[model samples]
Target: MKRPFFVVIVTVLLFIFACNQSVKVEVVTESSMRDSTQLVFWKNLGDLYGKAFRGTVVAGGDGDTTFAGELVMHVRLVEEGVIKVPFIVGRDSSRTWIFTLESDGLMLNHDHRHPDGTESESNMYGGKTTNFGTAECQVFPVDQATVNILPTRTTNVWWVELVPGSHFTYNLRRVNTDRFFSVRFDLTQEIETPGVPWGW
Candidate 1:
């Protein structure tokens, strides 16, 4: 009995040692997923003038998920010289007002423009856009502090990073449209979901 027990113990020990010899190990750190070399720059929004908004604003993600269209339309109000007031178009087609941003927290003018010479179902600014020619839209200024900050619905404005560099910037607008809609462009990436924050 003693000899059989001793043989069993020795065999188990040898098996454990052999398994350890062939074991492979690896270590991963959090910094591996972080990007330290990313550079972002922001350019002032020029006046966007066109005949129409073109096509629908589609929403997508870097992941494997998909969603329906969110932003149906948008408009802005441009005074002869004052800054243009940007507004959004809701799915229900109602023209909701937005608190325009001026130099400070003071309320500025609302965007009010329409192509059919009628009141816009969405926010309207004096600016114009054509199907063939390029439209004009003003770009908001971006600062270091405001670089990654998201938009506040109560304030009804958001700044998107049209162009990103070391100098992070954003495009300011009132997200009055439904939670899903947005403006799609080739410049930078714009993302939004039902419950996700405005800017991510």
Candidate 2:
């Protein structure tokens, strides 16, 4: 009789413990900043104004390895119609980034990889990048909310000027081992609306 009672007590305790177990759920925050149509316009503009730029990299080391590479950037309209750009840096050594403006804050996100096979990210004031790939990526603020450019590593203040109805010149530069290199990423496409609409 005592053995039967002990088994019953153990079964009841196990049932209670199982009943008290908690279930966890994940939550993701969605931006209420841009509406669907506007966001679509921005994405489309990014696709339209997207361009791929190629250049020669010259760096210093025991033995210099020269590489010719290309980068593709898709520019979208942001908060105040300022451009929000998402870009991929390379085919061999690549990093993807979402570039945007927040209030008075200029943010650059570097979603790169680590040697230990992990995802790594760097946040910058205007632009943030790491020297992981023998090259660095960056962005600069030109106006209060417009015409930013990512010049070469050595460019102190290279900027692009855009006058809506007229023509605009986008200037970019890169430097390796004190050698200033330059490349012009032409505006290959333009979209006044979002090209690829996603997100809630």
Q: Give one digit per residue, the lDDT tens place, for model 2 in 1-200.
A: 36798898999999999999996866432333233322343344344344333322222222433324443444433445355444433443333334453443334443444434355442221332221111112234333222233333323333232322232233333323353333333443332332232210
Worst 10 residues of 2 by lDDT: 128-137
Model 2: runs farther than 4 Å from truth? 1-67, 75-86, 114-117, 121-182, 189-200
TM-score of 2: 0.33
Predictions in order: lDDT: 0.31, 0.37
Residue-wise lDDT of candidate 1 within 84-157, one digit each (tens)? 31233333233322323332221222234453335543333211111111112222232222222422333244
lDDT of 1 at 60: 26
Candidate 1 deviant stretches above 4 angstroms? 1-46, 55-76, 80-91, 95-101, 105-157, 163-183, 186-200
